[model samples]
Target chain A: MIVKSDEKYSTLGSLESELAISGLKSGSNLEKLLKAGYFVVTAELGPPRGADRTVIEKKATLLKGYADAFNITDCQTAVVRLSSITGGAILVGLGLEPIIQMTCRDRNRIAIQSDLLGAAALGIKNLLCLTGDHQKFGDHPGAKGVFDIDSLQLLQIVKGMRDEKKFQSGEEIEVEPRFFIGAAENPFADPFTYRAFRLAKKIRAGADFIQTQIIFNVDKFSAWMERVRALGLHKKVFILAGVAPIKSLLMAKYMKTHVPGMDIPDEIIKRMEKAKKGSAKTEGLNICLDVIEKVRKIEGVSGVHIMAIEWEEAIPEIAKRAGLLPRPSP
Target chain B: MIVADIKPFKEIMRLVKNYRKICVIGCGTCVTVCHAGGQKQVSEVAAQLRLAAKLEKKHLEVGEETILRQCEHEFIDSLEGLVQKYDAIVSLGCGIGVQMLAERFPHTRILPGLNTKFMGAPTEPGIFWERCVGCGNCILAETGGFCPVTRCAKGLLNGPCGGSQNGLCEVSPDTPCVWQLIYEQLEAQGMLDTMEAITPPKDWSVGQGGCGPRRLVLEHLVEEEKDKHKIAEKVLTRNDCKK
Candidate 1:
C-alpha cells in the first residue's frame, strides 16, 4: 500500500507534508519500504517521444501497484522523449511514486541542478543517475552530447544538494531538494575485476542504492556480488539486480550480439529460440521470473529492477506471479 | 603539430573565381610534414588551378609560394611586397597560419584552402591522432599521461563511463577507450588507488569554456616590449614637441 488511489496532489505543499511526516532523507515511498526491510520491486517506464500525456497516463494505470517505485527514463538510448522530470510529475499526479532517471548525456551541471530542483518541487523524491547511452544509438545521432559531468559527479552533486545543503559551487541552498539517490552499474562490462571497485566509487560518491545493468548471466552477477560483499560495499549501498523480460527470440539474439556492456548467455538465447511459436513471450516472462528468483536468494541483493522495455503490460502479471504483489505500505 | 586537410578543389575554385590573379601560399612547417600544404603541394595546386582556368576559358594568373612558417611575423614579412602583387592569396596553411596571414595583409583577401584539423602527431606514415586539446591545465601527470579531455568522447574527468567495454569506446569500435588505457597504465605503476579516488569536476573556464578568445602572455618577454614601446613613445613625443 503506497499512496491511496483516490488521494493525489501535484504540488510542493504535498511534498513538504510528505517530508514533514518522516525524519528520513527523502521520505519517499521507495526509501521508506527499503528502510523498513521490504524486498523492493522497481520497474522502468520509457516516456513517449511526442507530447501525449495520455500515453503515460495509460502506462501508469497498468503499473500503478505492481512495484514499489517506477523509474521514469530520461531519453533512454538518447532518443528524445517527454522529459523524465515531466514524466515523474505525471506519475506523482496519478498517486504513484517515480524514480526519475537523470543522465549526463544532454544537460550540463547548471541544467542538471535546475532540473533536480524542479523534479523535487514537483513531488519527485527518487533519482537514478547515469552516464547515458551514447547519442549515436539514438534517432538524433547528429546531435551534440553535453556530458559536462559524469554519473559519479552527478551523484556527488545531488548528494551535496541534499545532505550538505549546498550546490556544486558550494553556494548555500535555501531549500535543498532531498532525494533518495541511486546509480547504475554494468557488471557485465569489461575490466570485470574492476566492477566491484567501480560500484564502491559510486557509493563513496553518494549513491545510496544501485540498480545494475540488466542481468542475463546470474553466475557472473553472483561473482560480482561476491566481490562486492568482500569489499563490504554491499553494506554501504542497497543493490538491486536489474531484470528485463525478453520480448522475442530476435530481441534476445540482438541484445546478445549487438548491445554493448550486455552479456546474454548462449543458453538463454537457445532457450528462447527453442520456445514454440507464439510462446516466446511467455518463455521470456518465465526467464525473467527465473532470474528474479535466482537473484532474490543471493546475499546483499535488496530488490529486483524489472526493465520491461515497451512491455509495461507484462509488469503486473510478472509482479503477481513473482509474489511481489500487494506492495508494502510506506 | 597541427594536422590539416586540403580543401576540395571546387571550393578552392569558388573562393578565388572573382580574383584575376591569385597566389597559393603554403606553410613549410607542420603542413609540410603532414604532406598537406608545402612547396610541392603549392606547385601542384597552382598547376591544377591554372589548368582549370584554361579549361573554363577564364583569364587567370596563378602564383605559387612557400614560407618557412606562415604563423610567424618574420616569415610572413619576407613575402611583404611580393604578396601585394596578387589580387588574392589562398593560404594552404593551418588555421593559425591563415589567421596570421589575414592579420598581416588585412587589405588583400586571405582565403583558406585547408581546414585545420587538430593538434596531434602521426601514429604511422599517414594516420594522425589527436593527442591534446590545449586545455591549458594539464593533468597528465596524474592520469598516467593519457589525456581524457582529448581522447574521451565525453571529456569526463572521472570516467570510463559504462560505455567502456573490451577496451573500446561505445561511441565507436575503432576508438580505443582512453580510460581503459589509463587504468592499465596506472595499474602497472601500482597506482590503482589513484583511479579509485573521486576526481572533482574540472575547472573548464581555463580552457575553451572561458570567456571569448584566450591568450598566453609571457610577462618577462612582454615587459621588454613594453619598455621598447615606452622608448618609442618618448621619442615620438620629443619629435612632436620640436615640430
Candidate 2:
C-alpha cells in the first residue's frame, strides 16, 4: 500500500484519508532524492507499439531497483505506442515508480485534463510534460498535430491544478492531482543562446524538475550548465542531464545527421568508427559512462537521465559503471 | 493588410480550363501592395492564361481589370458591363474580395486566383509573414508587440514552449521562435515582469469560433438617425434665430 505523506497530503483536507492508503502523493522518491541532495539517476523506457503488458513488465522489472524512477515515453518520435499512462500504471503495479510522460502532439485541452486526472487516479505521481515530436517525423506523417497547448502552458496548467487546486478554467478540483511536474529541454537545437532563458521560463511556470535532450557534446553541455548556474537557476529546479548509450557507429551518425536537435560531436563519431569489429557496443557504453561522469561533475546538474533507447539491458551495467548503482532508498 | 500569395500557374490554369473567356480582377489595395493581386499581377495572369491556352491548342479570350477594392460594392460595380461578356471571373483579391464578387454576381463563376494567406505586413521586398490571427483580443502591449496567436506554433499565451532552441521553433529551423523575440524585447525594455503574469486562455467567442460573420456598426452612422440629427439642428437654428 502506498502511504501518502501527511505533510503534502494535508492540503487535500478531508479527502486525504480516502486517498492516503491508495493514491500516490505529490512528492515522489525522485523528489525526495533531489530534496536530500543525493545524486539522482533516472531512466527512460519507450512503451511498446503493441499492447503487451509482459513487455512493459519485463522492462520495468529490469529497471526496477536501478533507477529511482523510470519515465514511460508518450508516443515518442510521433510513433504511437502503448499509452504512457497505461505503461506507467503497469509499472506501478509491478512495484516500480513510473514517471508518466505526456505530450501535446495528440491531445487538446479537454483530453489533456481528462488524462491527467485519470493518471492521478491511477496512482501515477511523476509527469514529464513535453511538446512531443512533430508528426512529420512519425510513422503517420499525414497525421494532424494537435498542439492545443504547448509544453510551457501545459506546465503552467498542471502546476495550477496541483498547487492552486484549480483547473485552467478556474473551476476548483475536488481532489487535486498532486504531481511532481517535469519538462524537457534540447540544449543543442538552435539559436544556441536562448536555451537557458527558455529553461528559466519553464521553472517560472512551476516545473519541479527538467530533463534535457540526449547529450553527445560534453563541452557544449558544460557551457550550457555554466549559463544555467550563472542565472542561479540551478537552485530553483532539479536538472537531469540526458545521456543515451549509442549502440553503434551507424546509430550515432544517423542521430547526428537526421535528428534535428541532436548535436553529436565529430570526435565521438571518429572514436566510434575506430572501434574494432564487435566492439562498437562496448565503445558506445564507454562513451555513455564518460558522459555520465562528466555531466555529474557539472556544477548545476543534479542528476543524469539515462535514455538507453530500446537497450534496457545496458542500463544496469551503465548505472553500475557510472557509479550510480546501489540505488538509495527514500 | 491581408497578404496573399498567387496560386501556381498550372493550378490557376486548371481552375479556368472549362472557361473560354475569363476576366481576371485584381484588388488595388492589400493584395496590390503585397504583389499578389494588382494591375501588374492581373496582366501577368491574363498573359499566362493566353499562353497556356495557345500551347494546349485551345481558343481562349482573357481580359484583365483592376479595382480600387473588390470588397466594396462601389468598386465591384465597375465590372457590370465587362462581366457579362466573360464566362468566369478570377479574383486576385483576398478571400473577402472573392466572396464579394460572388455575392454581387450570383450567376457568374468566381474563382480565387490568389490564396489568401494572413493579416500581416511585408518584412522586406517580396517577403511577407503572418502577424495576426484576428482573435479579436489584442495582447500586444503585454507581449512586447510579438503575437503568439499567429507566430507561435502552438499559440501558447504564457511563454515559450520547450521545443524552442537557439531561438528557433521546433517545427522548422527557418522559423524564428516569436516567444524568444518577445522575451528579448521584454528584457531589453525592462518589462520582463509582465511575462511572469499568466495570460488566461483567450475568450475565443469574440474570435473565429464564436459565431457568424463579424459586423461592426456605429449607431450614429445610420442614415435615418443622421436625418433626425439634421432636423434637430434645424430646430435649434430656428430657435436661435427667434432669440
Which candidate has the highest DockQ of all?
Answer: 1
Per-candidate DockQ vs. reference: 0.60, 0.26
User: Which structure among the candidates has the greatest lDDT?
Assistant: 1
Query: Which run of 10 residues does model 1 chain B get worst, by summed lDDT?
Result: B203-212
Isolated chain A TM-score, each model: 0.93, 0.92
* Model 1 segments more than 4 A misplaced: A1-23, B229-243
Per-residue CA lDDT of candidate 1, range B1-243, in tens? 999999999999999999999999999999998988999999999999999999999999999999999999999999899789999999999999999999999999999999899999999899999999988789998899999989998887775777688899888889899999998999999998888888887777888756668888899899999999999999999999999
Give the per-residue Cα lDDT of candidate 2 at A179: 90
lDDT of 1: 0.89
Model 2 per-residue lDDT tens digits across residues B58-140: 99999999999999999999889888889999999999999999999998999999999889998988888899888888999
| DockQ, candidate 1, vs. native dimer | 0.60
